[model samples]
Target chain A: DAGVTQSPTHLIKTRGQQVTLRCSPKSGHDTVCWYQQALGQGPQFIFQYYEEEERQRGNFPDRFSGHQFPNYSSELNVNALLLGDSALYLCASSLDLIQETQYFGPGTRLLVL
Target chain B: AQTVTQSQPEMSVQEAETVTLSCTYDTSENNYYLFWYKQPPSRQMILVIRQEAYKQQNATENRFSVNFQKAAKSFSLKISDSQLGDTAMYFCAFITFVGSQGNLIFGKGTKLSVKP
Candidate 1:
């Protein structure tokens, strides 16, 4: 019964570069959502993926995109990263859309310098 | 769009005492859900408790409980017999009944410090 897992607990990227964060959904879960948490702030929704398609997205720029694989794993890609992109990226897995409780991962901390 | 607000940016409580974190939300819809998530220093987001809009009894989990006021659109979390482990950043989240397609709106969060 493994919970949601994310890769690269910490990462460093340079401005104008690109970074990819990976997430594996919890067992028995199908939906995957991504969030960004800045220092001392709560997480803000990035987007959600279901059935290999992005279902809903937050007020993020086009530079932020995501993909969900057949195995329910997800990858968040940020292109042309800026220093403001530096934050903790959290991955959550839920069973369905309607008010389901989501289980979250430890999150990947990205530092852009 | 639904919005959640946590006015208190920080709070402190003595160990073995009780503390309450405040939260309020605005939504036009009749049905929705609310949640309290705790993010400790490790950065793992843990669900503390949740409340469905239709439930009037409120929701409780162990030492954590919620005071849900539908009319006031207020949802506050109360932690009793607080321990050092309970120190964390607490966030209030809201979601409508429209299903998973709706995104969760989170408050700015309240940082709780438990003094031993």
Candidate 2:
């Protein structure tokens, strides 16, 4: 019974560069959501993927995008990274859209240099 | 817009003592959910406890309990007989279903240090 897992525990990217962070949701779950936690701040919603399509997105700009695969894994991509993009990227998975509590991955720390 | 607020930024509790972290939220909806999540230095978010708006009885899990006052929009966590392992950043969160989507909103967090 593996929980949610994320890849590249940490990443460093320069301005104007692109980076991809991956997430494998907890077993027996199907919905994946992404969040960004900045230093000294709580996580802010990024977007969520359901049924391989984006359901709802937060106030993030178009530079942030993500994909949900058929296997329920997800990848968060950030383009033209700015120093402010540096934060902890978290992936949370739920068994369904409305009822179940979400399980989170350890998260990927993204450092935009 | 719904928002959760945790006023205490940092607090310390002597081991074996009790400490309560305060939280207040703003929302117009009558039905929703509130959660307290603990994040240790390792950064994995763990659910501590949760409360539903309509439930009158406070939610409790062993040494962890919540005082949920729906009318006052206040939800606070009380940890009894605190242990050093309880030290972590505690976050208050809000979520509500609208049609079918509910985005979790979290407060800045309260850092609790259970000192031995």
Candidate 3:
């Protein structure tokens, strides 16, 4: 019974560069959502993926995008990264949209230089 | 839009003692859900407890319990016989279903430290 897992526990990128973070949702889960947690702040919703299509998105710019594979794994891509993009990227998965209890991964720490 | 607020930025409790963290949220919807998540130094977000707005009885998970006042829009977590392992950043979150979508909102968080 593996829980939600994220790849590249940490990442470093430069301004104007692009980066991709990966997430494998918990077993028996289908919906994946991404969140950004800045230093000394709570996580802000990025977007959510369900049925291989983006269902909802937050206030993030177009530079932030994501995809969900058929296996329920997800990838978050950020382009033209800015120093402010540096934060902890958290991936949460729930059984379904109606089930609000989301299990989160350890998160990937992004550091933009 | 809904917002959750944790008034206490930090708090401390003696080992084996009890501590309560306060949270207040703003929402106009009638049906919703509230949650308390614990994030340790390791950075893994763990769900502590949850409360459904329609339920009158407070939700309790062993040593963890919540005081949910729907009219006051308040949800507070009480940790009994606190342990060192309980030290972590606690976040209050809200979820509500509107139309065909659901929204999850989180508060800044309250850092709790249990001193031995």
- TM-score quality measure for candidate 1: 0.97
In order, the first chain's TM-score in every candidate is 0.98, 0.98, 0.99
Model 3 chain B poorest ten-residue lDDT run: B95-104
User: Which ranges of candidate 1 are over 4 A from the true structure?
Assistant: none
lDDT for residue B88 in candidate 1, whole number 0-100? 93
Q: Which window of 10 residues has the lowest lDDT sum in candidate 2 chain B?
A: B94-103
Best by lDDT: 3
Best by DockQ: 2
Worst 10 residues of 1 chain B by lDDT: B95-104
DockQ, every prediction = 0.77, 0.85, 0.82
DockQ of 2: 0.85
Candidate 2 per-residue C-alpha lDDT over A5-86 given as tens digits, one digit per residue, 9 for 90 to 100 = 9999999899999999999999989999999999889999999999999999999999999999999899999999999999
* Ten contiguous residues with the weakest lDDT in model 3 chain A: A94-103
Residues B5-116, candidate 3: write the lDDT tens digits: 9999999999999999999999999999999999999999999999999999999999999999999999999999999999999999998887657757999999999999
What's the ranking of the predictions by lDDT, best on top? Answer: 3, 2, 1
Candidate 2 off by > 4 Å: none
Error of 2 at A72 (Å): 0.7
Clashing pairs in 1: A97-B100
